[model samples]
Target chain A: MPEQLADTVDPANWTCPAPLRDQPVVVMGHGGGGALSAELMEQVFAPAYGNAVLTGLADSAVLELGSARLAFSTDSYVVRPLFFPGGSLGDLAVNGTVNDLAMSGATPAYLSAAFILEEGVELTVVDRIARAMGAAAEAAGVTVATGDTKVVETGHGDGVYVTTAGVGLVPDGVDIRPQRARPGDAVIVSGPIGLHGVAIMSVREGLEFGVEVSSDTAPLADLVAAVLAVTPDVHVLRDPTRGGLAASLNEIARASGTGVRLRERAIPVPDAVANACGFLGLDPLYVANEGRLVAFVPPAAAEEILAAMRAHPQGGGAALIGECVAEHPGMVVVSTGLGGTRVVDLPLGEQLPRIC
Target chain B: MPEQLADTVDPANWTCPAPLRDQPVVVMGHGGGGALSAELMEQVFAPAYGNAVLTGLADSAVLELGSARLAFSTDSYVVRPLFFPGGSLGDLAVNGTVNDLAMSGATPAYLSAAFILEEGVELTVVDRIARAMGAAAEAAGVTVATGDTKVVETGHGDGVYVTTAGVGLVPDGVDIRPQRARPGDAVIVSGPIGLHGVAIMSVREGLEFGVEVSSDTAPLADLVAAVLAVTPDVHVLRDPTRGGLAASLNEIARASGTGVRLRERAIPVPDAVANACGFLGLDPLYVANEGRLVAFVPPAAAEEILAAMRAHPQGGGAALIGECVAEHPGMVVVSTGLGGTRVVDLPLGEQLPRIC
Candidate 1:
């Protein structure tokens, strides 16, 4: 109503894609951790909390505090059917956050677990989830050091939603981030992709396709540590969780002002996952992966790092997927087995919501 | 089921108290941060995690990693009516977790925020809340370094729920924990109580009590730091939230294995808060105050710490409330104005749920 406040309240000034310009309410895509998610962060959160560390927009924000470098990250798991083929929400909450820290070449040391339990949920269920979290934390070699629990009125919340925040120590001489990707860096994936997303989808839809596709949800810290031990000069590391490899590549390309070229035959996607994606009319490249990570290493150290990764159990299926290029800066292109190249665009929204 | 698996699945051995024995499902009181909340943690979480750091059950866990002493804590804010009189859920999310770290005599540094948003909530609402969080972080001199966003289906969530985890640096020689209370320690409160709870209740009930009760939701890191500057030997510092001062005092008494005697007349309760509590049939002592803190200081250092606290704007109304006693260990008693002493037991649950 006031003259001075009119400019602050103008809706036209909000930066969003043309398709999303008229949208006034949040949609599933906004939380899909994709293009819309980026828009939300760039337009709303970035301006409000104008800080340099946050501007990096890495999976985990790396900070220097009192001569110590730390990697801090947070994730909320609201997966449907708390339990799935290979993992439960509890394990996902723990391993997911631990993996986020590992993506930054940090050794995750401690985690904080906060739960929102709906009223009337069975105590036995709570116990089961808590035990699963404990087991997962132990498996990841991280501790659930502190926590808080709250109950929402029935109907206001689902069974339970768990959010985990992790703190880790980044080793000296290691500088890994999205913006560190260089033009000649080799792109490598730690293991098979799309299994985690397809596994959740199978359970949700109650469709068993003869072969069960279990989630690839495991901690990647050991694998990352192995690679770092070989060489701390690794440029960038990212766990393709929500928007999958396509989004991760796009983010890296944009951040580093470089282009990406992927070899379709070299990308590791299990047969079961491929079949499931085919049946669901989805692309494996855009499906989420809980455990796998994408790393960019200089050509000189790529062979050693890849071998180090493959030696680890979690990275047994490692593959050289792509490489950064100067041809199409900020674009990703994949050469199909048929000798044709297709542009791999970031998914606008996740095909599977709450997959993590 | 197999015989061995059946034994593992049995819930009969869960260690809940007799009063909570019949609670087959979660109740609002279980998350009230009171007796039921303590029961939930002890019965469900503690047994499952089985870790020493969690056994301490302090507001924040003090960790020694590398050469740095760190304090880590977390909380989830599901406050109703995102905007209240004095503070919104946005600021509350930031200040609440910051205060938790401060309670451990740490200088709050970095925070991670995770949001669970319901589909269809207005984007403007989210932006407003995010802006408020930015402002609050600035006021507290902490950074929202990293965050996560997830959306639940409509009707499954209430607008937006926020969870924040904070990490801070604890100075050497500062040993603050609930069990640090000594027999001769003096109890002090930073400011008035009960406004935060009543403020939420007033907004929820749509009642106008002539005077609008504003929440005392504020950051207490500076106040706690000031006291530590005066004396790092200050025994305990607690931000009375959830079940409020009564719950905090009871927790301290039990942890220290000592009795506490309170001078009811010395406890500071804002006249408006007291009037609101009286009208609503609530005890001001048991109502929440987000901004205030309770300190247990040695008899010799009490004056110096109290004076230091009073010098800070947030602790301007500081008062000496009570003293820890050797009689009737693990109990708290208050001397009433009517020449009678009354036991102050922790409430079974909060009178108001979702009061942040």
Candidate 2:
């Protein structure tokens, strides 16, 4: 990892392809899942890994094998400060991918966990992480069926980095993706927003807002199932994780060719999170959340779906926040509480780095 | 990643559970897929993530989701030097996982790739790796369906690390596991061993054996399918990777409560790899191979299966190495080329570290 170390790899053997001239090197924003992340995928990954399922770029890929259809997803948790207030890296590792599959209306059944450990990491820490993953998978009613472990020399890794990939069963009648959003579809959020990002930031920056803010990193498969039980025709579902609510909305708008109009007043942001964001000059809508989900459904079934989500433990704060519109396609406009309309473009990168 | 850095985590929040008292801290051997690796799983991972499927400790887990029978597996590639003589990390990532599913008697259909990047790494290098993955997946007949990317601060990573998880369809009546290796089963290995381990070590140690030794890393799903075409009743299929041929044979012997008798003279070992291991004081028997597979099949169908395997491009070097015996259950004994018998116990760890 040090420059002085001599190794066989030249590190300059392969030059960047012509298409990647804009960014000769990778920046932090490239991993932000925002505009930069999109460009990276479109130019680099999507072109190299050309396939319909990957081209769609949804949270989870629905694949058909033989006579079965299943949802598969992958996520690597690289959150700074391995342990946060309400959760640890292990919690995010399991819940994040499970939630991705859940967002596709798939009943998450199994997960594959691969761990990259630093050479000198304490075994106790890894044990704790594994226990946390076990508990989370149990809560989500999924099995951690297969795994691989690799260790890098000290200073070459950030203690422990876990990449988990999961597979789930998608029901026959259910079809969901970001592109399913349509005009007039009502958008509802599962619960309070911005808790996860704020929690990581508070612990990272050592700034307290009088009250403790913990991450809302809980598994939401149950919440998703409850919502699906109410209606299988749900248009779209997204878990606002890395780039948060604004990013998800922007992607949906662009993919579906629909404009999104949000009622900022209806969006639920706890007072503590609001105060923290105010003090930090951060927008909660652009902040990340782990255990929350955004659902777009036909307006007719929105109320019932909202009711079902609210009844679930993971979605106690469900609220109807917006609706898809035909005007200003590929744009998201918010009607602020201050009685002004604001366009919410996807941030070039996430406000908080490594806030997963 | 430096200790002086101010972070929220204390790194001492959790204590090692009672069961892991033997190894107070994780070492490189825990990832070696040998004795230490097995101990970690049995003592730490298995207890925490308790499930029947996980307890089996197979290369891939076969699950029944609804009416679908599928195989799920995961692997992380942290091989140092990034690029090697014959292949790169990207090729290893895809082929490793695909071969795992194929060993489970499944047809690899899709893969999920997650990358952890070190900030400031060249995007061109990333593009090359992605292209390599695309080509490997194409050769393996699998789609790169879903993926995630995260970047850590410059010093917290080794340029690029890839973790790929794959899911594939398991044909009806196909059951393959290490525990299925029984007495009277013929042991056949596809292609030469030790090439991959020697290739990696040559680059890492700056050793040259007059002749170039390239890694024998290739996709083996088609070869596995060819074997299956001859017969689905094959007892065990193992793609010797991290722990190499010796480790795999030991595991199969222990798992099935049978003894493995090998004719060392018949086990294919290229002269270059043999000479390299000789100079390095390494055992070619414990060296790794990426594209090779060791099959345990009934003696009745061994010839036909061998013929089918030899007919495939990936299995041109296929040779019958040995057979399972009831004499020394849970042990492996090899008859050497020098007309002497040698007991091959699993190495406590691996001779080559971070090798695929």
The fnat score for candidate 2 comes to 0.81
How well is each residue in A1-356 modelled by candidate 1, as lDDT tens digits?
01111222222232345666588888888888877787878888878776777768688988887778989999999998899988899999999999999999999999999999999999888888999999999999998999988899999899989999999999999999988988999999999999889889999999887799888999999999999998899999999988889889988988887889999999998999888877878888889999999999998888988899899999999999889998877777899999998777766667878887
- What is model 2's DockQ versus the real complex? 0.68
TM-scores for all candidates: the values are: 0.95, 0.94
The prediction achieving the highest DockQ against the true structure is: 1
Report the lDDT tens digits of candidate 1 across residue range B1-356.
01111222212222345656686888887888887788888778877777878768689999977789999999999999999999999989999999999999999999998989999999999999999999999999999999988988898789999999999999889989999998999999998888899899899999767799999999999999899888889898899998889889988988888888999999998888888877887888789889999999999998988899889999999999999999867778889989898777766777788888
Ten residues in sequence with the least summed lDDT for candidate 1 chain A? A1-10
lDDT of 2 by residue, B153-236 (tens): 889998999999999989998899999998999999998898899889999989999888999999888898889888889899
Where is model 1 more than 4 Å wrong at Cα?
A1-17, B1-19
Candidate number achieving the greatest TM-score relative to the actual structure: 1
- Evaluated on chain B only, candidate 2 has a TM-score of 0.93
